[model samples]
Structures are given as structure tokens and as C-alpha cells.
Target: MHLPPKQGAAFDPLSEAFARDPYPAYAALRATAQPVYYAPFDIWLLSRYADVQAAALNPLSLRSLDHLMSADEMAEERRAQNWHDMPFHARFVQFSMLNADGEVHQRLRKLVFREFTPGQIERLKTGVATYVGGLFDRLGGPFDFIEDLAAHVPGLAIGRFLGVPDEDCPQLRGWSDDIVQYFDIDRTDARKALAERTTKTFYDYLTDLSKHRRRHPKDDLISRLIARWDTGELSEDEYISTCMLILMAGHGSTIDALGNGLTALLRFPDQRLMLSADRTLMPTAIQEMFRYDAPLPFFHRYASEDMEINGWELPKSTKIGLLYGSANRDPEAFADADTFDITRTPNRHLAFAAGPHFCLGNHLARLNMEAVFSQLLDRYPRIEPVTEPVFKPGLSLRGPKSLPIAVR
Candidate 1:
């Protein structure tokens, strides 16, 4: 049965209401019999867990259309999507491993695979804890959790992993934010120019740092990657872009996860109290938080050939939007899905996504959450929100923009 995809007439992802709470709209999307065709992005949205996981695991579904589209076609498409005219972003941000598929993605991923494994990420635990403890010590009374605490943690943790100087992490966070904001729905000229300019500035900084690492090789990711470049394993562009991706991938997302996780705890006091009473639940609580509100929610996939998803036919080159956030909340996929429960077992959420393109820095992201929340629980016996947190408006990211809290 070749049924037509449902029209997503009521799905307005850019609306302020969606920004405040998208789960209701997501629920509507999931209730449809077939995938919904959202004309705004010309992409079919898959909200169900089964449909999304199947598409992600399917070899025909790709992150990039370059394999199926001609150069001219790609150029035109880029312009159509407002992704053209940015040189540095095109070179690095646009062409990075996140957008690559097949062997290229595998090769790029392989280069850094060992560095991000659970064991490798475990080594970073001490550094993350020490830094987080210092931040907690500096806090007094009511403070903006996102700005004062959450924002500062990821940059230092990921910066240390990539061998970035502690002083430079803050600037790198700003650069990452500007570059990533353009990836969302708003592609205004100002945002494009800002993304481009920031990329160039970021590129130059990495280039200089790479040079220094080459001369005085240290025991860090950059120094190690430098050896690979010297051995002709990585091109200059590849080397620089790889470093940029590592930093950008983990920076804001981790920060957002922290903020979202804290908000979840504050909202569900019982769950918070459960985890607080039983510290063993911290790890599970962290996982529940990511499942509850995935930071990087919306990602797209392109079908390289005709495919039938749950009996609905999708033609080649059809853009399929994977709503990971929605999938995480689907009632069919999770019992009591909407309820925030720290003790939920057998949780198989798609927060880090799945299949080949699963987030490489997932372990590190989880570790940061555990460290911060564990330290927070230990430090503050009582924590309350001073003001209600407002989520950033966009379909691409999810998190409280600023969360004011009082700790005693």
C-alpha cells in the first residue's frame, strides 16, 4: 500500500509556543499513521522511534546528498538552503564528518575513535570534577546556572580533551555558538556573516595552535593529530576541520544538557530527591535527563534511493527529518514517556541518536553531567530556582537560555 504522507499543517517548529514546549506538537506528529510532510523544509518528519531508528540504520539513508547529486545540483541546493556564500563554513563546518557518509565518515571517525572511547573519557573525570568543584566553591546565593556554572564546564572539559588552553575555552564557546546558530531555521544574512567571520577567526586560532604543537609536541589530541598530519594521513583542511568539529560538537550541546538536566530535576522534585537520597541513581538520572530533553534534537537524513518506511513509499532524494527529541518522548517507545522518572529502567532513548552517525562525544557529555550534578548534590543540600527558565527558540537546539537558582 503506497499511502500518501500526512500533511504537517499544524507543525510550526519555529513558533514561540513550540520553543516553550514542543512535546505536544511532537505528540501530534507521532499520532499520524504515516510520516508527516513538512513543506517548510521540504522534509518528511519521522517522529516514531521505530521509523526513525530504521531510517537511521538503513544504508540508503545518508547524511549528505553529494553521493547522489551532481556538483551543480549541490551548489544550487546549497544556495536554496542559504548555505552558500560562506567560504570557511563551507570548507570546514559544512564539509566536516558530521555531514559525511560511507567511507569518508568512517575514516574520519576512525581517526579519533580511540580517543573518545569509555576508558579514554574516564581519564577526563578527575579534571572535570576538579574544575566543577572550583566553580561550585565560587558560587554564592542566587546565580544564573547556565551562565555562571553550566556554560563554563563543557568548554574547559572538552578544551582539556583537545589540548585547548583554559583561557581560550570561553572564546571558543562564543565561536561555536555563532557557527551553530546558523545551522538552525534562521539563515539571515547577519547570522551567515557572523558564522563565516567566526569560523575564519576560529580557523586561524587552531592553525596557530597546530603549528606550536608541531614544534613542541605535547601529550594531547592536537599533538597526536599533528603526527597524523605529518605522516600524510590527514590533510591540512582535514586536520583543522577535525579539531573544529571536536570542539564544536561537544561544547554547546554539553552545556545545554547540563542546563536541561538541572531543570528536569527542579521540575520533578520527587525524582531529584530519589537521586539525592540514592547517589547510585545519578548515572541513571543523567541518562533520563538526556532522554527527557535531548539538547540537539532535530537532524536530517536524505534517501539515496526509493525506500518503503513502515509501508509508506519515499522516493529517492527525499529529505527525512529525524526528530530525536520526539522519538525520545514517544509513548510507544517508552512507558510513562512524558513523566520524568530517574529510576526508569531499560531506557533506550535516541538522545545521542543511533547507528553509524551516533554522537562520538556522547560518553564525555554524560560524564560531564554526572560530575556536575553529583558535585551539585553533594555541595548544596537545598537548591531552588529563583526564576523560571526560558528555553532558546529554535528547532535545532533545546535548553534553558538562562536558569537563575538559589543554592544553600
Candidate 2:
């Protein structure tokens, strides 16, 4: 019996050093290859902007919705861990768009698109502004912006969009936190237990909400999804899956962007001040922040067929990890890439991804960030970081877990 060679120092993608600051390691990794580099953990890392972008768009090369994890693997690693039970896993398996492909992905996306259109998102701006204003008005002295501010807004806004009750906002936030924690490799049994409990509770609540929407449809996204289900355009499983995806993805990514974007600004004060002084810079600044400190750093894909990319041969069924975070910082793509410049021109970042699966909530995420930052600067111009921003323990979603700041 032979074991895989002990993970090499030259390629530990999940190393503590790399996690703390992955830019330097990514740069080193990118220097070695164009499309593929054999990294520790038996992972194939895609780092260059062109390669990452290409891989994301090329569905024939990289399929997003394959069974990346085996049944035995899920049972032993995920289930035996006693984190969550069969029903919880079943719900996620049935409905998550991340696990769907081809016709299913397209149909589900179309249904979701009808509900989350630009007009609906535009109407959400005032509500988001009002929510941010109220939250910021209550803040004084020092606070953890991630906890006190960034995390709350998206969950609240998403709740409103989905017609989730006001009292359930905190519960939804708690569940979202737990679901995210399940993705953390370093997560403890306790965290898993908590997440499992939250998963059951959340699903029960959503089930009840689904029932309610069935009886009394309203002008909410949930109602629209229910309408589709009634017309036989969407299956019951699809409805459940789409709703869960919208609730979790819609809120989680935006929360990360808000927290991560603010942390980036704090790390570079000059850039922060530039945006603070000139309100007009908010839009470009938001794009730069996304490019500079992407919340969802990497996306996973399975190679659908044997292919050659950038001169390297890849076998079919290879698990490819597209390093969007690294690509955004690639010097070959962006001049002076490592520097956090709010004024970066022609910033074609793959933060929201690209191609057929480009994030449907891109506009909403941008709008929410712009609204929050613009309101924060307008009311309290003296916002500054008071402590180091603590990042979450997962490479998948990169953002601060807590950001302490002083705001006048």
C-alpha cells in the first residue's frame, strides 16, 4: 500500500500562512504555470486571470454541477460527523443550483431571474438605504462592523425580498452563519452540531413559509416561485432548492462583500479617504474593492472531458479549483496588482464569476455595497479600523469574521 507523498511545502493551498495572506503564495504559484499547477492537497489550482476567466466560461471544460463528492464520502465525512441528518442533506441536495447543471440550471435560473430582476432590485434601494441609516444611527464609539453592521443588512434585506418575517431575521442570520460554517474544514464538532440543529430549524420554518405562500401568494419572490410551481414549470424540489439558494447565496455573498470591502478600505487608508471625500467614486471603488478583496475567492469545477489548457494536459474528471482571488491580483492582468487602488481602471475582475453561471445577484450585491458605504461615509466620515480584521476560516468564502472599527 502506498500513500500520497506528504503534502509539499511548495504547494500547500490550505496552509495557515497562505490563508492569512494568500497573495504572495498565489503570485509564486502563478509564476510556475499558466492553466494548472499541482498544489498540495492533490488540488489543481487555476491562477491566471485569463485562465480563470476562460475556465469559468468554458462549461465544456469545467462542469459546475457534477457530483464532486461521492456518496460514501458524504456519508462518512459529512454524515458520520453527526453535523446534520438525512432530511437536511436531502433538502440541500434536491434544491441547490450549485449542484444542478445544463437544462436544470437554465430553467431554475430563468425562474429565479423573473423574481430578482433589475427593477425589483432597484425598488429595494430605498428600503436598503433606510435600513442602513437606522443601523448606522445606532452606532457610536467602537464596534465590530462585521457583527454590528455588515452582517445584518443583507440578511434583513433578503428577508424583506423573500417575505421572511421581521422577527425571523436574527434566526435567518444565525442559520446562514451555521450553513457557512459547515464549509469550514477546521470547524469543530460543536459547530457542526449547532449547524445541524439550525439546519433542521430553518428548513422547518421555510417549509411553513412555503405552505403559507401556497395559500396566500403575494408580490414577493417566494410567491412568484410558488406560482411557477403551480404552473408545473417548477417542481416542488426545484422550488425548495431555488428558495434556499436565493436566501443563502443572496445574503451570504453580499454580507461577505460588505465586510471584506470595508476591511480592504481600512487596510489602505489613502484609498479609503479618496472614496470618503468624493462620493462619486463609490461605484468604481466598489468594483475595485471586489477585485482587490473578493468575498468568494474560489469556485470549484470538474473537468468534463480530457483537454489541454495553456500547454498542460488535463485528464477528464479532474477536480479544478478556479482561484478568482489569485487571478484578480495577478500582476500580468492588472498593473501593480498587489496595491489596493480604488481608482483601478478597466478592472475586469472575476469576483462575481462569468459566463452561463455568472452570479444572478451581481447587481444587487453592488447596489447594496454602494448604498451601505455611501450612507456610512455621509453620516460618519471618521470611520477607521481599530483592530485587525479577522477572516473566516474557509477558503471558499473569504471575508472578515469580525471587523472592529471606530466611527464618530
Output candidate 1 Cα RMSD: 1.2
Off by over 4 Å in 2: 1-9, 13-15, 33-35, 62-85, 93-95, 184-196
Which residue runs of candidate 1 sit more than 4 Å off their true CA positions?
1-9
The digit string of per-residue lDDT tens for model 1 on 185-262 reads 788999999999999999999988888878888888999999998899888888888999999998999989999999
User: For residues 1-408, could you state the per-residue lDDT of candidate 2 as single tens digits?
Assistant: 111233355755456666577788778768862437655544577889888887788766545423445666656644544534546645663247765778878877877775567888888889888888998888878988888888888877788888887678766777777676665445577776666676677777888998987898878888887888889998777776676777787677788898878878878889888998888888889999899988888877767776655555666766677889999998889998988888888899999888877888887888789888998878777777887776665567777778888887
Q: Give the clashing pairs for model 2.
A: 11-40, 95-241
List the lowest-lDDT window of 10 residues for candidate 2: 1-10
* TM-score of each predicted structure versus truth: 0.98, 0.89
